[model samples]
Target chain A: MISQLGDGFLALAQPLSFLHLVGGFLLGLVFGAIPGLTATLAIALLLPFTFGMDVADALIMVAGIYMAGIYSGSITGITLNIPGAPSGAITTLDGHALMKRGEGTQALGMSALSSAIGGLVGVVILVALAQPISALALQFQTPDKFSLVLLAVVTVTIVASGPLIKAVVAMALGLMISTVGIDPMVPVGRFDFGSYHLVEGISLLPAVIGLFAVCELIAQSSIPASLGKAVAVATIDRPRRRDFLPSREKIREVGLFTFLKSAIIGVLIGMLPGGGASMASFIAYAEAKRGSRHPEAFGQGSYEGLAASESANNAMCGGAVIPLLTMGIPGDAVTAIIFGVLLIHGLVPGPALLGENFHVIAPMFAALFMASIFIFLSMMAFGPVYLRLSQINRGFLYAFIAMISMVGVYASSYSLFQMWMALAIGVLAFLLRTFGYPVVPTLMGIILGPYLEEFLRRSLIVSEGDPTIFLRSPASLVLLGLTLLFVWLLRIRPAVKRGRAEAAS
Target chain B: MTRLLRGQVVFALGLAALNTVYASQLLQMDRPFANGEPGPAFLPLILCGFMYVASIIIVVGEFRTAAAARESAPQSDVISRIALIGPALTISATALFIVTFFYFGYLVSAAVFTFIVSLFFNYEKSGDLKRSSLIALITAFTVTLFGWLFFVKLFGLYLPVWEL
Candidate 1:
């Protein structure tokens, strides 16, 4: 085992491999920084480009991008209070407050550093436990997989903030979208309406990109700007310019504890399908506040406050990959895109890969570590420059954003139709935002809908479309019970509490 | 009602209605499999049912909240419900631009969209054609750069080049 690990380390040390990690990291940060761009979008957009590249190198690039993407999102969340991605949403609470307190540099530093630690720690756990976990996963059959996914669905239902009934509807909205186009058994087009594009069903990536990015833009346009304009980058910190910007001592203090707690949270959350870095960050922040000696310092921009979220969100990545590579389930949207990339690479994911391919598996683990280190150093070096990027004037920024949308959407597929679709969706998203409809779920739906639907279909096949099949499986039944319980907890119970509070007051 | 709140209700209702119409049609159309098993319709059926219940719940919640506000509050301080027209018109213009661009061409569409949406931002500022033209020129150049260099040159994709 040790020898194989050494070979993996050597392979990753090649200058090209290190370079690839750096490239992926920076690319991810840039994508993550942009409002309409995200880590998953970045990966999918980059996929066509890697069609001819070496598989190992390609995987390394994707991995680096994935890790860095999650980390860089907090940059925007902290400084601008606009999440660079959904996962970064938790950071906005304390991170942006720190910026408002004129501790932008400190928050940025703490977030970046802690995220690095979380990511690296996650990588270590992956190295040690992935094979063992995958071996355990082999015990799962269709019943288990269905149960696990159902458990995820339950989590989503519980976390949703509307009427339990409404959230269920929204989830069903996603499932409905997934069943379009073709049924897998007959493999014949079902809802295509005779269009070639429709036959392929709705492309999940475009839908995600549309619902999250484009629709969000539309929503933003509708709202009165309540918050001050997103903050402008004030200072560029380089060692040459200033020995160090994010006070290393402060970073170290926040980074260590946050990273450790975040890793545990991430792995546990990652083990569950519905849980991801965002939830981990939210929970960790709440925990950190609860346990803190300085609890009152929480929403007011405490250094440790920012650290808690950044670390946990990054740690969730490692936890997420455990289920993905081992059990053939995507941990989150990032892993979902990676799953798409894996398919593109001709690698079949499951116990078979774990059992037979140490050559691939070992380096992949080492690459995760190298990628985290590479991005951390690169962020320290180049991240301060990004402060300037955030401050770009709104008019200029809008114009450039428009330009980016036009180019990015059009470039990926020369089809004018797709470009138009992206614009339409973006505008719609912007409008939706104006109206106060939560937008993240729409994106989550687009990404997860297909997988959820696929599992539903396969479950039907294994059980002759009997609803009882879902109930008979212990895992599925437990998950269904949990779902019911969660609906009661988040949706029904909250409304009931509010009702009682209003009456008393 | 607060104009903003009213708009949200309308949009929410519209969204629910759209889901209902589309999902219901789908479930109705899909035939069951031959073996007396549930078919593709099952998921859609489940989805439509949930949407129906959820939509009703959401509207009920909205109305209850709205009613509670009406009893206590005095007249609203609406500057103008027309203030919403800016966003509405801007969005409408965008949708129209998308429709017309393919129907006519990019150049015409760009000119029209730029002219109309400018009204939303600063019609007075746009009167300074010096500034508006400058911004418009930049917008035009930006479109060219993104459409040609980034989209076409780098990625081997094509946009509707309205050179004429």
Candidate 2:
């Protein structure tokens, strides 16, 4: 596996491919530094770029972008009050407060060191545990797979931010779209709607780009100027006397302690359906604060908070990749896209993981390691300089994003229709964002919907249409039972109590 | 209703309408399976049913909110009705853009199609010609670069490209 990964890296070492790594890192930095420009948006835009490239190069670029993108959010979080990414929201607990106290550079420095260490540690876990995780995945049967996907889809109904009805509608809409292409078991088209293009159903790249990125742009345009202004970053004239070594020593002490703690947190969260960097970072931040000697200093701007978030979030990189590489389950949105890439590359993640394809794991691990180091060195050399983009005008800003969206959509297969699709969806997404419909759940449903349906359908097929297939498989039964238990605890029981209490009142 | 509620209502309604349309599509579906088992349209109808019920619940909930609010303040209801128009126009314009995709071509069609879009939101500053056009040109160029360089040249799938 290690040699395979080395080969993957060596393949990427060419001037062109190596430049792609740098380009991707730089792209992540810019996107992460921007308050609303997210890794999701970046990857969506870059999807078109992949329409013409090798799947390996495309996957490598996006993966690098994703890893560094999660890490780079702290740069803005520490220097500016804004979190460049969702995962970095916790970093603002202490990062911005510390920046106000003239430790902006110091915080950024700690963020860099901790981010690198945390990412490296996470990669180590990925290397060691991926094989074991892959082995566990082999135990899954068709019934298990189907039931698991159901549990995943149903899990959203309980935890979605909006009303359960809205969540259900969104999920149902996604499932309907999933059936547009040729049916897996059957030969003829279902919802192709008479168009040859429809025979392929809705393309994942264009559909996702439209739903998330385009919609965001529309919402952004509608926002009042007050909401548009990004958080201000105080200038650092003295630059904290350049004390990174001291900070590193301090972080090393903390990193040594939280390394294991963060890895455990990341793994636990990564195994969940919606568990991604955001949740992992949040959990790690809470744990770090819980264990810190200076808990009072946390929200006010503690270095430990920064360390915890950067490390845990980056460590989440490995955790998120585990299911993707081994079991074909996507750990998060970004990995969901990676699942798309793996499928495009003709790698069926399940049985393929146990075979000679052990080669894919090593290269992915190595790429992640390289991407992390690149983020570290890149941030040290160039992160501080780009802290001033908040001042850019709205028209130009959205225009730039629109341009990327256009070029990216068109590039994704040289298709004008895809561009229109992006613009169409961007407009809708923009509206949705304005309306406060959480986009994440919908995206999650879209990405996971098909797999879940296939799983459920296949399980029924295997069981001769017995719905009890879910009950018969130990794994399926456990997953479904746990899901039901969670729903009862989180929603049904809580609602019941609320109803009783309200009646009494 | 706040802008949030209006959006939820519209999306819910739109999804309900989509379910009706998709269910129709499913009924018309060609059955290709040999086993005489449930075919492509089977689960799709189930899915549409799910969409319908979910949308109904959402609309009912939002409508209840709208009805309750009407007794307190009619002005908010009027404001919401007015605000919903902008999005309706925006979505209609998007459908128009998609419909005319081949005629407009990727670059020209998107620019003209969405120029009013950018203008509708950002055209108040008449004095800033350079910035606005620069933004427009950049937007157009983005269409070209992403379409040509990234998707067509690199990833190389047959997307819906437009040319002479």
Q: List the candidate 1 regions with Cα displacement exceeding 4 Å.
A: A1-20, A31-62, A76-107, A161-166, A194-196, A223-258, A343-368, A383-386, A395-434, A443-466, A474-505, B1-9, B12-34, B67-129, B139-143, B156-164
Work out how many backbone clashes candidate 1 has.
13
Q: Give one digit per residue, the lDDT tens place, for model 2 in B6-31.
A: 76688778767867777777657644
Per residue, candidate 2 scores C-alpha lDDT tens digits across A1-505 of: 6667678778677776677677777787777767777777777767655655566677668767887788877766666677888878887778788778876766777777767777777777777777787777688888787776776677655566656666665666666667777877767787666878678767777777777666766555444444444556566653323443336556664657875677568666766766777778889989988998888877887777777877788888877787677777675667777766666667776645636566554545666788878766765676457456455555555555554565555555556566665665556555445544555566666667667767666766676667887788888788788888867976799889999999999
- CA lDDT, every prediction? 0.64, 0.67
Model 2 CA deviation exceeding 4 Å by range: A230-233, A238-255, A414-436, A485-505, B1-7, B29-36, B63-164
Chain A: TM-score in each candidate?
0.81, 0.90
Docking model 2 quality class: acceptable
TM-score of 1: 0.79
**Model 1: DockQ against the native?**
0.26
The residue-by-residue lDDT of candidate 1 on A388-473, one tens digit each, is 54543233333334434443454455456666656655555555545444444544455456556567777777787675878887
